[model samples]
Target chain A: MKSHDSHPHYWKVFATFAKNSLIRDMTFRTNFILQCVSSVGWTLMNVGFYLILFQYTDTIGADTGWDRDKFFLFLATTWFINSIVQAFFMPNAEEFSELIRTGGLDFALLKPIDTQFLISFRKVDWSSLSNFAAGLVIAAISLWNLSARETNPMVPSIYEVALYIVFVFLGIVIMYSLMICLSATSVWLGRNQTLYNFWFYITNFSRYPMEMYNRGWGKPLYGFFTFVVPVLLVVNVPARILAKPIDPRTPSEWLLVGWAFVAACTSLLISRWVFYRALASYRSASS
Target chain B: MLTAPTWMNWKLSSWIMIFRTALEERLVYRGDFALGTLMRFLPIVTQIFLWFAIFDAIESKGENPKGLIGGFQFEEIVAYYLLTMLGRAFSSMPGLASGIAKQIREGEIKKYLIQPIDLIGFLLLNRIAHKFAYYVIATGPFALVFFLCRNFFINGMPDLLVISAFAISLLMGFLIGFFLEAAIGMIGFWFLEVSSLLFVYMLFSFFLSGHMFPLTLLPDQIEAVVNFLPFKYLAYFPAAIFLEKIPPEDLPLELAVEAAWLVFFIVVCRLAYGRGVKRYSGFGG
Candidate 1:
């Protein structure tokens, strides 16, 4: 059999998807503008709420050491990570279920390429770039504010920046795997849009720092989200790397990375297994 | 001029018809109605948990943090947020009015116009129908859960009266919101895109109306300015009434202001509809 990686058809499929996205976006200039405004407006609203909270209270978590700027930095990083996930993975998950419902998946499956890849990257929402950019601006502002307020003047080392990037990529992979796992369930369930939405809703908890839930009932719940669901690793670990330097002698940071890696791999394996299982049960709605 | 008795009877019967149709429609879509209600309440649940965590942390610090912050007890804050959430549910019906206006601009209003009813009345009825269903299924259960969890009570009969007054104010608030959205929606006839305008309006509602947080919690200068705006009538006033933060004597005057705003928006909506319909070239017909 021909190697799948060497196939020119894979590149052709990606090009077609990119071209279609460009065409669709060009047709709706007003939507693009509205989307950009919506992203910035939502970010401002969220930040405003946090600022109000911080104004009244000095500490959020068990640690009184971290201030408002650090909190804002955590939030901004989460927003950036979330926007990227929404831009890529969320659309794919949404489209996957929609395609299954509408029988659009038949056309995709018939194509001489990997059905998963074709379904996942069929269209990228260009407007999500606006959110990504807005998040970057907010993160920069937060970092500047933190620098001014920091009791301990510490600069992020090159290794820390590189590690942050790696963790962010891993977070995205984990999130994508989760989405695929959910979407794969749709092959049998047919139109599990509510389940998808519920997943998104649960993920909203990660927008704030995991430290906020460091104790009490919140601790156990946060642990589930971090270790089991692993959404917190998407933002919390990356932001922590930049904001607080952990000693390399300590094994905690390494353990977190290893856990994230395992979770990502497990989710991907489960997704593939679920997809095959659902495929076995699948009878075309049209037929 | 019409006789008072005859006019009153006609108005009463028309309202009855609208109510009956709305009730029936609500019954037809109970599942979706329940889901919509859940969606509305989810954010409140998340927020309450967050506040609970914050209060617990404060108490652990061996300081009266709650007392120090603006004389509000932790329970009072929860009550305030609950009232705010209820006001949000009631006042947000205006979004449908805007959706109707969009349909009108797109010439889809003709379909409704062909029916033996006023389009505005029909749209209003649709909104009330959904809200009625929501109230019966969603709001009732949500209120019960909140009250049970908080175990708080109104002080006296006077406070109960104030709560009643607040309910009336919320209805008025919804009408004002509806009319304002209708007026804005009519602008779709002039502008092909109104989402940005709608978003700006939503931003104003979220901030100035104190939907996200109480105006009192905001900076003093910003609070003073926002209080004068009609946005506060939609959310803050009703919430304050429920919290018994607003005195019973003030209820009548506050409701009167809300009624006046409703009337102003109604007139503006009527004028916009008149002009917008005349300019309708039926591009989407």
Candidate 2:
């Protein structure tokens, strides 16, 4: 696969993997359908919870500009990014330890492919796409509502929309990097039982706007998550780009965007380094 | 009738033995418990920030700046979350449903069928032990956090009556949560996969139990609806008792309702297990 990488057939490889995943999902039709229902049900329930919350309050943050509709867009963006990550990488991370235990990693290593790509995209949870669809609908509806509001007409330009997509893509990359880093740790830990639990706890912070963490005690947390973990960038930057709750032309806003791009690149490099190091430490079961 | 006493004594002793063994097993992983508990508290950071943001947004510019939103002052809300964390420590069944489903899927559940052991009783005893160990191990972290946020409590520690009610609610919540999850797990005997159903149950419980936010923060109609649900007993009711959110006059009725829900779930769990056993098909050796 490395030898043929110059042929520019990456899309073909991804398509094959996706096809295989869809076929596997179809084999358990009822289970797949139920999973889809469950995912969508959870998303709707989340929306309902927020709806209830917003009934008593006008905005999530004071003057930070995450009003109800704009916050919905943020939540929708969270769902979108999280769904993609879960669909593509979460299941792989979950099974990483099992693969290690069974010497499946040895087989993977032998394959003529980029090990990271093979490991990350091995399983695609098609059912998670239900949440993706739900998120798109919610985001669209929220954007429409925000734009149509009489008080402030915050219709995003095409360039802003493009930047929003780019930031969202960067968010996915950062999330994927974090997941792969944890999954790689299975090489040393033998069995990382807390992988998903830790992931859930860490990513929980990212679901809310980063502005929420700009206050007194939260300022330290913001610094740590922004610099060390980089989770704050996952949802906030893209949501900010689309919502434009704060002036996008502001220096701080531009700084955040630049910082997010830097975080994405740094995280990818760090996780790749960790994966290779863990690989070096790995000993096959037979050995 | 004459042999009932001896049989009951024997069963009680066995359950005690099971509980002790489970407790011992749990203690072996105290380090993991402590770490996991501390990690779980990480979410409170986000919650604190989020609630602070909400209160800041709702701040009136002039007189009565201390106006309580959702019938809770900022400090009270923080205190409520601390109590809720303690409540969850008691009632949270992390893997109870899925564990049972896995056992059933693997045909290991046949061990209970063959033995005199009652599955639900065994599971309940194990969970009691698990919670016991968790509280013992996690108390330090809980204390540190609570001490740090001590000012959040409006009146500091509650009186004996409130504490007793809070304890009772937590116990009842544990039983309700266990039986509810066990009943869901029993569905695995009938269906090849119960994961989706379990997921739905978890989603509902997370919202309705006020694990995410105070039920009082919800709309009045929805709060009323949540009040009727057994889930509120899991995390919210115990915390509410600690906060004195429920009126003294209403305490007895609420406790009775919680007990009733526990009884209902217990019966459902038994029925499901019994019927499930009838349909059991063996799996891998």
Candidate 3:
């Protein structure tokens, strides 16, 4: 009898898959390098654009507690989360629709490993990780500048650092769950070419400081993205944790930090339910 | 007093037939493009929120917000961005350059070479048809959004002369966008994959063309240099003209320069395509 219970060597399997992906990438060495360079180039333009904007104002908004350096740190954290999503989840999410259209997901379901695990871990686009390295350089520089502030230098505490790490991981969980749900729509819709466009529209909300959305006409968008989609916490909580010291005066920021955990867990469960439900409805179009 | 080429002697009805077929094909995919166009406006909504916060901060700082940085008021900046979106819709060639590169790489240009129809002429007609179909579907959403945001226009309307000038630049911008992308595509004859180069080109065009922000927002030194470059005509110049950023005194000269750039691109693409076709060889049927 064939054994289909589980594979104990999931990590080993992932490593091998990653190794094969590297090999495939190396086959087009110039393309891989160009991809890295182009991504970095785009990031630099964004930084430059904001640099000019900073010349006009000391902060992104009035009394939002974000200075130039803090905003850079927040921007770097945005890059960190984005790089991880684009490197790992985005490629898989893009392929998920194609698999459904081609009936490849049926074969994926028959595998010995967990369908989600096998599906998500299959390919690793290392070129996308160049942005993560770029983010790290920016983050380290921002940290140094933050510490070197003459008057009110902000050095992160151990507790803050711990919270930052945990929140970053939880942020990834929330983003992954949202992406999986979007990809699951392809099973019903068939040939989901708009996946990337929708992803871009959704992530555009999370990229800026959440404070930017707290004002007049933006209030509706702030509520919708925060409560319904919960992307606001994806970068906000961790970036804020590093950029500022914990203040007992501000209960709302603390409330957000607490909510990230709840949001992650809820999204995880909702995504699991959605994925299987979509799978149950999936009818293979390819022979 | 110049006679057109022999290929131009083809019957008008045949040209009309080709144009109609391409238009119909594009119309079949109009729903998808219309949705894509509508989704694109989401960024502008975000821009509104962003700029409002920035200007609000400036307003709190107790300065006359009318003539702040880059010579733009809060209301004008929003209107400028809205206008640039329209300019981009006109000048964006989408997959034109890369599609040409792909055709050249895959030997699909063989069909064009073997046929009596000129490759450039055929592609231009097809693109015009495609654009027609897009504007047909996109006009509704664009009209609604522009109407809603009409209050952002501090200066309500311009005279007939300015309106005519703005319309002329937009048409020229479309032709310039086409020829510029086609010239880039001709590079496929020399390189197997120009998609990466195309990506890099797009990055620069997106930045330098003032699609991201007003060219005037750049430091004065950089703005002076950028004003002379052809890139501005792509997205910036038309919108700038419409916004009355260019004074009436300089309008005629600016239009002349824009016309010169359009002619320059047309020449460059024709020359490059000719040389590329000379070296192109198809291996199999």
DockQ of all models, two decimals each? 0.38, 0.69, 0.70
Please give the distance, in angstroms, between residue A250's alpha carbon in candidate 2 and its true position after superposition: 1.2
Model 3: pairs clashing at backbone N, Cα or C within 3 Å: none
Candidate 3 residue B171 C-alpha distance from true site, Å: 0.8
Per-residue lDDT of candidate 1, residues B1-285 (tens digit): 879999888777887888888788768867765675565555554565666555654666757644434445566676667777778778886566458656865678777556655666766777777777778888656766676646433342234587688779788878877777777888887886677778888887888887877778788887778777889876887877777676677778877877888889889988887787788765443
Q: What is the TM-score of chain B alone in each candidate?
A: 0.81, 0.92, 0.95
What is the C-alpha local distance difference test score of each model? 0.72, 0.86, 0.86
Model 3, position A159: C-alpha lDDT score = 90
Candidate 1 achieves a global lDDT of: 0.72
Query: What TM-score should be assigned to candidate 2?
Result: 0.93
* Cα lDDT of model 3 by residue, A1-287, tens digit: 12456545889989998999999999999999999999999889888888888777776777776777888988998898889988888888888888988888878887777778877778888999999998998889889998998978878889988988898889999999999999999888876677779888888888878878887788888998888899988999899888983344388888888888899999999988898888899887764
Candidate 3: list runs displaced more than 4 Å. Answer: A1-6, A245-249, B1-9, B63-67
Over the stretch B12-52, how does candidate 3's per-residue lDDT look in tens digits?
Answer: 66689889998999888777888888888888877877777
lDDT for A138 (candidate 1): 77
DockQ of 2: 0.69
Q: Candidate 3 chain B — worst ten consecutive residues by lDDT sum? A: B1-10
